[model samples]
Target: MSVLDTAFVDTELSKKTSIFGLHLWVVIGIVVGAVIVLIPSNLFASLPRAAGAAARALPEIQIDMGKVEHRVVFSDRGASSGESRATSGAETGSFGDENVIGEGGYGIVYYGMLADNTKVAIKNLLNNRGQAEKEFKVEVEAIGRVRHKNLVRLLGYCVEGAYRMLVYEYIDNGNLDHLAYLHEGLEPKVVHRDIKSSNILLDRNWHPKLSDFGLAKLLNSERSYVTTRVMGTFGYVAPEYACTGMLNEKSDIYSFGILIMEIITGRAPVDYSRPPGEVNLIDWLKMMVGNRKSEEVVDPKLPERPASKALKRVILVALRCVDPDAQKRPKMGHVIHMLESEDLLSRDERRIARDSSSSLREEPSASRLEQQTKQ
Candidate 1:
């Protein structure tokens, strides 16, 4: 209606138009920014799915024998055949010398070196083809998924048409049995069931490592509790498990307890040279322990002195481990703690007396000394 009002209206219209244009530019910038951020991610996310689908669609090739059909499982891209040694790099040899460290009734152990120079222990089945093959597969599958510091590591495997082998981390020191028995000149009183010094290996620092899973069963697992054919070394086998064929985790604990005792006393579970009354190391230890004399059970090579509390605690722990009833024995975790802790248990007086007797024996012979002095 008025000229001034008309001019003001036109200015307001121009401002509104400019504001709308700015808002539209802002919306466009946001859309462009989102596209820049999300496009690459979406493309990358779809790649794995697409590759997997392509793989699934590809025809699977199989080799047919008279009655057996074998499937080739692809491990890596560009791998021509599955027969290639699972080892990394191109280095190839029989590995017979490098891997073969020791032998036993069941298998032979070899020291294998990987491409990265990481050493591994390879156990090759010497006999029992079917059992070895099954064990190799079971171990690979079971150990691959399980991880623990105390347990040995499984690296890889080799199966060349009946030549079955398992690869594991290489321990520099031989098995625990050797240190406790052969080298120490002591007899192992423990029923390892499969007890031979070769089963236990030592690390570079001589820390004991338990190996040989071929016969190992997870004691806690229900599957392992089932009755099976009796198979184990005579000396290490628990009386109950050996006789009844009822093997459980306690069987392993019993064996471990015996091992601990052997480590402490430096005597075999069953020794032919020992007198008739002292044939069984466990029985002998029991008698000495019951009579309050532990020093008599200790290794002769060990120095004769007052029975330290440390020695008593170790003996107690060993006894607890070898309890006739598996239910009463402590778990490996507790055993490890008792071994490490100095204050957990106390020493017996008889042990001190035995130590004193040993000390007297070490002293010079009085008659011989007098004769030499006169001469």
Candidate 2:
């Protein structure tokens, strides 16, 4: 069994064994409960020294406290004497759905104002663990220095006691997690290791700006590929990257293909709500293509059916983008070319157009000797 399967089996078996040993467990539980009842209540209370030591053990990511103070406005409840606070008012600063911009793995991004009334998106990180702290620094150092028109700029950060937060320039339309946002042309060669719908954000002009650089890797002049631990959302990960941990721009291409299909179908990569055979997007797509029922793959909720030719081209491009072999996958620029070209879905058409093409060319089957011929 695979490691993941083994882990799952062991967990399920452990649960079943616990259930079967209920009587013995109950007896042991009673003794443990009696022993706990005899122990002092003070032991259960907060142990500040231990908590402090644990927090201090991890390498601290430096933050300019002066810059953070300008944007982070803590209320009386949020801050205490000798702590950072914007005001002495008992009410908390604006940070909610009413002013809520977006949400991600890190935390809720709130539309809020700085002391100078500058509009900002404040990400309130929910986790305070050491690993989470590293992610915080990763995001800050990764995108904080660079200024790009297509990327949401990280303005500053705040770290007070256990609370950690980041401030970003607010994008009015929010994110594409629900596949609800659509942005115009954005051509960046950067490989977003995690390219799910949620990581895309729409601006005031309906332009999509990619967000969440926490899992992103820059393919600079120095290097274009790396072999590391497989990391990313399941359905969007490339077959090559998932199997061998070999990552490059094509890995993101594979994920982008999945994202396009997500936009087309309004379906997530994996959904238990779907039928057994239709649970996975790629598997379902292949099944549909094999059955020549590709038309059925489009989301029924769409207001109007897209032209068959246009739709076919889209599906063809998506299929090519997700080809199993990493070498066969097209660059993002070429994928864009296919999307814009009409009647350019088939290999023959693309080949005639003088565009570079790759194939799923299968190997010939080995010949087996017939009984009569052998005799």
Q: Please give the range of 10 consecutive residues that has the lowest summed lDDT in model 1.
A: 181-190
Model 2 pairs in collision? 183-208
Candidate 1 lDDT (Cα, 0 to 1): 0.46
The backbone clash count of each candidate, in order, is 20, 1
What lDDT tens digits, residue by residue, belong to model 1 across residues 306-361? Answer: 23444455555556656665655555545555444434333432243233223333
- Name the best candidate (by lDDT): 2
Q: Model-by-model lDDT, in order?
A: 0.46, 0.51
Candidate 2 lDDT over residue span 256-373, tens digit each? 7787677566688889899999898877775665555656777775444555555555565666667776766666556655554443335453442222122332210000101111
Error of 2 at 86 (Å): 15
Which residue runs does candidate 1 get wrong by more than 4 Å? 1-100, 113-118, 126-136, 158-164, 175-198, 205-208, 219-224, 303-309, 336-375
